[model samples]
Target: MTGRRLTSLLAYVTTAATGASLLTGCGVLPGATGGSREPVTVMTWAPDQTRATNMPGMPAMAQAYARWVNSQGGLDGHELRVITCNEQNTSAGAADCARRAVRENAVAVVGSYSQNGRAFMAPLEAAGIPYIGGYGISEDEFTSPLSYPVNGGQASLIAGHGMQLAESCRKVSLVRPDTIAGDKLPGLLNSGLRKASHRSAIDIPALEDAAEYSQQADRARTKAGREDGCVTAVLGERTQTFFDSFRRLPTGAADGDAKGEEGGKDGKEPAVRISSVLGSVGQPVIDRTGGAHSPFEGAYVTGWYPEAADKSWAPMRKVIQEHAFADNRVDPADAGVQTTWIAYTVLKEVVEGLDQDTITAAKISHALDRGARIDTGGLTPTLRWKYEDLLGAPGFPRIVNHEVTFQVVRQGRLVAQKPGFVDVGETVLSAP
Candidate 1:
């Protein structure tokens, strides 16, 4: 072969081996292109190998979704190309990811996870890129005009968690990260409690990346009282650690001798029930901590979406089984992964609605703004982004889905405590 042909062959072999495209900051899926349609590129970013909360599954799921869509002759005859980045759980890293998306000319940033929303949102907004289906950890996800969040963000989860606890918990203690974002949780929780005439939860701020939360756990236990009291932590990855410390307390000796994974028979020892949101405590966490014998056996978990076992997730599971079976990082049960799936669903629908030969970030945003109805196959309410459809809640006016599901860990599985979604738009509006 000639020199030019040999060099091109070498580049092709290297690209196939690494699964990266020649396009800057992109990893095009194998066989993602079809027909004569132009490929629509998007980006997904989440923290990995971080001291704080990491959502490696979010980006992994995005790639898997792209593969599945492309396998089915692409989305509306247009190839779906997904570029992933590690946000590193820092402001600088988030800004870098957004800049990369801009540099790569990504039409949208879909189904991504990042706590530093402000850092990322500015760049995407400046580039006129629409952000879809964020994991809802940051305030900017709800407040930014360019951000089309699929969920109500952390604001709804904490508020809905307070409502879920109000039904059974006589006294509630909340242990959260001692950061600016954490400062808003207490008031949101209290607002939901007031709906049931319940008193405010005792706010206990703790380090988000602490190795162990023994001191905060002890304080939470003390503040929660003995009977019908509940302790809820929203410390992301450290939530499991906090619960571990909570269960190892001297007061838990009464239930120590229990055999098998069915440990929490009549609820936790010392009678303080544990609780948390879906992102902090999930099926993966429960399975890791001993399934049915987990410290969260009877824990109350508030979630933006339905339980993983719900039939609504059948499509997502199918995609994962086919495209991401070898990739262990993509867990269908993970909230971050689930959010990415929903976000991409929105992207596909919005793109199809445009029905244009050329797709652009401005066009996608305009299509969403003009009320492109997105049905997430029952995972969430039919999503629409019209100006009138927004919840208009304080600090989260762009929130369209104020519904949350109340879930419980039973026999190593997270199941719905109540059927259907509970609308917390009113509670969120009442928050300080």
Candidate 2:
């Protein structure tokens, strides 16, 4: 038969197999094994060796989390079983990962990153598995009934970045990937800028996997530096490379302003300041690019969580030290790695909240649906999900954390620009 027809047939077969597994008392349904003290299994999937964003750290962190929890006698009394998948940055790859998660009888998929939300959400919903703490790359993450997104994803980041730029930047130029998923980014950012009555930013799309972004950088730099301008790039892993290209191009001294000895006797305004979100450009990149002298030295950044040096990360660092010490894949500062840590933190709370040794996918889903409040130490404001919790944002109905942390590169580190998170709930709700 046709490829589409074959996919449907395979899906039907998997559904049938899932039904059989549940009926055979395999602990796939709600409280399948009552107080049995069995293992609580979950899946974590992320792209690896892909043309764009690569999140190998997510799965590696999941495995490390499993080792850490299991060593401590697991979440509650059940062993934490983690099944990792490499999505390969493809829709088909994502679908395969979801099917594997269903077939393996995972209760939830936690702390993962994938741009192909539609491909994965269907299978997880079919099998009643909850998707917790997703990277928020796709729109379906906010709309899917089974998705419990911990952070605001790309939506909040772009919006917050715009607002952060409004007061200081006279002209803003956005550099983004030229992909279907990257299309919505420009509009989201414009919404925030419009809220401040600022003109919409210039949208510059470039090939996602291009080895060099020199041409795109040149165009962006010219437009962004026109008058107190800024260039913001959200091209995932390629963000740093894009800035590197921009930095190589010469930016000469200004001859217009000469005030005093302290204020640049003949100093001019910054040519074009660099900016990005957490996943695209962060501390790890800064450290590698010569720290304080990095291209992102004075860049503005937005993120879902606090800095890696924050004391809140100590617990996760301790776990990493004990279990993943030698594993180079686990970078405590990587956004995906930090996301996984938070997702597992939520899972641990959810499993323990059941107050029973036995657990299943249905049980977990229902509990979250019933408004379970989970506290992630102080990492995030206590996350409690309810129907009313939905912000009723245009397409993103399930976004609960409309807050984003404003950060800037200082002394080669990504430090908080403002003291706390900026609430962009109203800003996102007003997005076109």
Candidate 3:
């Protein structure tokens, strides 16, 4: 089919998909319901069933949030309508989702995930629909004037990851995807390492969805010094595969484990420590691999939010338990789910503060751009989109919350290594 035909067909499918929600008390019914405020419609898209990183949970969480909020008479009396799409992890797919959002007259694209930032952002920009609370994997999420990011994106996480490993690892090897987004990882990471006067890491680029990484693993292991060295992989879903290959190596066993702090079993060559960012590795991955016996046991993790077990997540946990009890996709521990929850939180704040009879894309963006402050119930520092609040970092000027948390896997559970958030705004600014 031609591009226009494909877009038209996608719009039809997207609209049709939401029809089932009406029976579940979560569908959009144009105009006011029972004299309540006008309903606010939004879209949430993420890659599902993809070869690369798939975040079905992000859209799932958005739907769950809509159900929960609508159950409570909606957000400040305005019924919340959520339209979900599967971006399919392709540029065309991402663009399709954005075009559907426009066709559906969505006020904003909230709590969505997509690596094809350029593909999606253009359509949203042309429609004047604000891109809110995107999973910050692509640089476009940080640069688009219409995009309002809830987290500091990969730039903060990688930079913070570098800082997290600086004092511990003697040498670092970064195994990242060889893509436009992946190209920036080294500079961001190096900036953080340089703060501690540590040397630059060995940059090893690999396919994002490679079936195995024995070669890259071997190279990373060799580059990491024999003793007190670390290898950090940020290859999304393939991170597990990389580590699986990594451990099969003669020295991969007990990697990042304290048993090898001094040296390997032979007490001569130490196993390299392993690490990754939140999306690449999380509680779900650990639980699946074998909790308490998982390969991630002693691995370092950097994230944009507090640990999943933190008390701050109680509200989100409650929503998931009550409204999303049967939805296994909405894992409270998953960062995508957490981001969606936070994104909806921002939306709620924006909607309630408006107190308007009807909400629109222009109105939502105007409220945010005019210095609307959002309190995520302590999930993140107060988020505002004012020009003065930005980081002014090269290629990422929209980063306002440049804070990251340091986490470590202890007994197969990710826990905070250091209390409180670490400010990486300066580190992002100093990147090459």
Candidate 4:
């Protein structure tokens, strides 16, 4: 069969299986049968060996959370089965995974790590499945109710951070990848900075189409230089190329080496800081850039998870270390894993609250819309659904009563530079 034909046929099969599973509750059918117990299937990218190897802590963190959930008696006495698959970072793989989850009769699907969540979004919505922890801050994903995003929107983070920076400097330079996520950040940052003060100059590079790092970095540095001391913050990935270009610039070098005295030639060196709001996703790459090459000493980043210093995260951290990191011998740098775990926890709580023998997509949606709040005991912020917010958009519902925190990466380690959580207020996006 042709590829398109095959995909359509598979989708049909999956729909049929899902229907059967909802009806029979028997294990005989492909996706049918929760098998005597309610099933909650988590679909996330299988650990990428290349990325995981460099960051050995992630897989372990995911495993720990899965094991802990199973030990906790699972959702409604049903053992949770985590069905992870590698998407190869492709849309096709994500679509296939979404179909399989629905076909398999999963009460709720939790996870589609990174931007790959975009591919499964439509299918899950069509299937009426509730999704958690997948969509980033992309405008397209912000309007969908089928998806529940635990991580605050990326654009919100960029805007919040940019507003903070605009306080110190009037000029800002944004360095971002050429991807959709990268493209959206600059606009968000500019909007926020402009709101804070009308004098801010935002310089975004034209490297969206560039193929090589050297080219992108050169362009970014040129923009940085023109701003002079007025530029206060440098927001982007702290890659080796970024640092190399930044250090070559007279201002960057002076800021890095300057003691009590100012670093720039004019004794007014700009505060050149680099940030990647995605945190752990950017850490490995940041680490690879080498401390000598990339000095993030005074740079700040916005992250979804709390810093290790936050005592609030103790319970979550303990669980990860004891169950997830114990067998794997990994540290807690895998922010994605923690996010996945938190998403699953919320899903389990929402599902268990249904108090129904059999679960349906409509029922699950209702429970979430009722403003269910899953508390991770301060390990993470509270995630609650506001159905009223759902009416405004299509993707994940806009988070209400949410808090944001910022951290600085100093000497290759993340430090909680900001004091407490700052409320960004409600994020209401324009219709897509």
Candidate 5:
């Protein structure tokens, strides 16, 4: 459909959607009986059936939060009804879902899967709906007032972790897929490394396929001097290719034999440490590197959510264990589940803080600008909203400054090298 026509249709739908609330001066309908209440609907991209099972622990997490809100009497007796639809991981599908959400009079949206959330940004904004959750990394969508990013963007996370790496390593190499997420790594790391007050040599290869990463890894290993210099590697991938490539590379005595002993022909071996930003394939990376063939031994990774063992995340853990855990479905460690919890909590906060009985898109937007910090005990960083500065934006992106600290597996289990928490510092991007 044409943009103008689509815009007009959306406006009409939005009007119809909120007509009853407008007339009643509240979400409830007129002449409603005792205990009559308007249901606060939360829309997400995951289809109801699929989300309940496949997408990590989010369904349980969401349901747990819903139950918690309900137990607290649910936003002044208005019960929250979560309505999920599958965006099918496509922009068009996500936009269609957004339209449906407005048509259903959803107060806000949460849990958009990956770029699908970014795709729905325009429509959600046009429909005057607000959203929370992290998926979109693009700057344009993140800086907008209508959309609040709870999990933080990938680019920003990379920058933060890169800064941490620069403090200990002198040479850095990035191995990533050829997707949009992969493409943004070099620029993001370069900017991040500079801010950390260190200069490190960087290597980024254009990997069209995961198998092709072997060539890139080989080059990175050589440039990093095998095991002598303080070299760090940053890898990004959504497929098993990254893990496979890294595992295939020679390591330990085998590596020494293939490339000659330390200082035999190529001089001293380089002290190479590998690290990765959170990707869709993090589990595989952890699993592969934890085995005997582990290539990521001694590596560090940055992640959005805290692991289950993080002591700081005790509160969130209690909630998840008591309410979210059911059967074997919910895994709180999954980034998506943690993100959903944060988004739901933020939405609840905004709704409860409203002074007026009725809620409007404008009002919700305003509450977010006031910059509320949500402390869910440290499973994630304290989430805060920053107002728009002189840049003429509504606000700085909503940030959950949590970065996970993990050691690459040399043996079977993961070794904790540092405390895992969100990093909430302002990321200053600069020239590499």
Candidate 6:
């Protein structure tokens, strides 16, 4: 479809998808639920494939959290049973996961990642199971009243990149997939850049699943690193491959090298910087590339939460070490895994707040919908979702958290560049 047509379709979907939760009647509550002793069942899912952007660790993390929680005699005396699912990164698979959650009568779906929003969301919404802490890949996560997103998803990432680059870049280049979802990148990125009085980035669309992006990388590097230029890639898992190709090409004495427009009087040049969002670049990617020696060593990364190395994550790390020692499925630093941990934190708090009330999908959604404040141990500001929390951003009314953290890779670790959340709420709500 043409760009105009795709844009039009996205706009329509945003409108039709708008609305709060349906408050569907009770489907099935857990066995002996609210007895102050029954297990509170929940579902966690992600794509776990050898050849895709698999996040087997997400569900595994949920399992680990369950083990840790139950070992402590459960949350508020309620046993936690977490069911895992592999969405296979397909629409049909995502739908199946949702159906299983409904059939299993889960109280909530936590911290799962999937691009097939339409396939999965409708079933859960119909069943009244609140989707807490999704990775925000699909717009539906924000549009659906059932979805309680802990992060701003891609919308904030792209806009935050523009905000980050606007400060130092004379020009910017964005390398993205040549797909419908990707077509939204330029507009979102430009929203922040234009806000800063900077020119829009040059959009560079490339083959999503190609073997190598050498040509595209060359173009991006030449355009972005020319002087005070910057290039940021957001091609999901393929972003690493693009940058690998980007590294192999000799890009003019490296960035910040002498002889460029940003050259210091002492013969040191201020070359363009490279950047990406959380999923594409993280601790795992850095370690795989070469740690301090990795090409991403100096790269800027925007993320939904605090850095993995932050002291705030020590509790989560300790949980994984204590309970998930034998499980390679969970990575302590993977955003998918971290999100699962936070989602469970929210679940634990809400469940405990129930006091003696029976726990059901409807009850859970109602508590969150009516404004239940969840504290994430400084990982995020207190989270509450009332109508006032909504961003009113077209198609994404439920984005209560438009704040993204700026992170940088240092010596193989993801660390905070700025120690607090940067609000991109206006940037996103104002996007073209």
Model 6 per-residue lDDT tens digits across residues 1-432: 999999999998876655211211121123323343556889999988735477888999998998888777677767777898999988899999999999998999998999889999999989989999998888899999899998788998888878987887888889998876788889999998998999989899987777898888777867775577787888888888888787666634544332222122353333656888998788888888778667777678889888887788899999999999789878888988988888889899988888644578888889898999999997877888899988888867888888889888766678888888899999998898
In Å, residue 166's CA in model 4 sits off its true spot by 1.1
Residue-level lDDT of model 2, residues 1-432, one tens digit each, is 999999999999999998777754543233334335877889999999888889999999999998888766678867788999999989999999999999999999999999899999999999989999999998889999899989888999899888888867888889998987789889889988887899999999998777888888777877775567788999999887787777665544242121111112143335566788999987888888888766677778889888888999999999999999798889999898998998899899888899776789999989988998888877777786789887778778898888888898887889998887789888888888
Q: What's the TM-score of each model vs. the native? A: 0.90, 0.88, 0.90, 0.74, 0.72, 0.86
Q: Is candidate 5 or candidate 6 better by TM-score?
A: 6
> Which lDDT value does model 3 have at 64?
89
Candidates' C-alpha lDDT: 0.88, 0.84, 0.90, 0.55, 0.56, 0.82
lDDT of 5 by residue, 1-432 (tens): 999999999999999878855755553422233336555777766533332113535545667776666655666556666776766545676688888888888778875554544677777788788877745444544666687776556655666667657766666766544556556667667666777666655555554433436666666555655333333343333334444554456755333332321122343323555566554434444564444334444455566665535675565567777776563544555556666777777777777677345566667767776776666555555666665311221222344343445433334334454555534244422422
- Candidate 6 accuracy as lDDT: 0.82
lDDT of 1 at 77: 65
The list of candidate 5 runs beyond 4 A from truth reads 1-34, 46-56, 116-118, 200-212, 228-240, 250-271, 279-295, 304-307, 325-329, 355-362, 370-373, 379-427
lDDT of 1 at 1: 95
lDDT winner, 2 or 4? 2
Candidate 2 or 1, higher TM-score: 1
Q: Which portions of model 2 miss their true places by more than 4 Å? A: 1-35, 250-269
lDDT of 3 by residue, 325-417 (tens): 799999999999999999999999999899887899999999999999999987899999999999989999999999999999987899999
- Candidate 3 yields a Cα-based lDDT of 0.90
lDDT of 4 by residue, 334-384 (tens): 455556656666766776787555666678777777788777666556777
Q: Least lDDT summed over 10 consecutive residues: which range in candidate 6?
A: 20-29
What is candidate 2's CA lDDT for residue 171? 85
* Residue 318 CA displacement from its true place in model 3, Å: 0.5
C-alpha RMSD values across all candidates: 5.8, 11.6, 9.9, 11.5, 11.8, 15.7
User: What's the lDDT of the predicted structure labeled candidate 1?
Assistant: 0.88
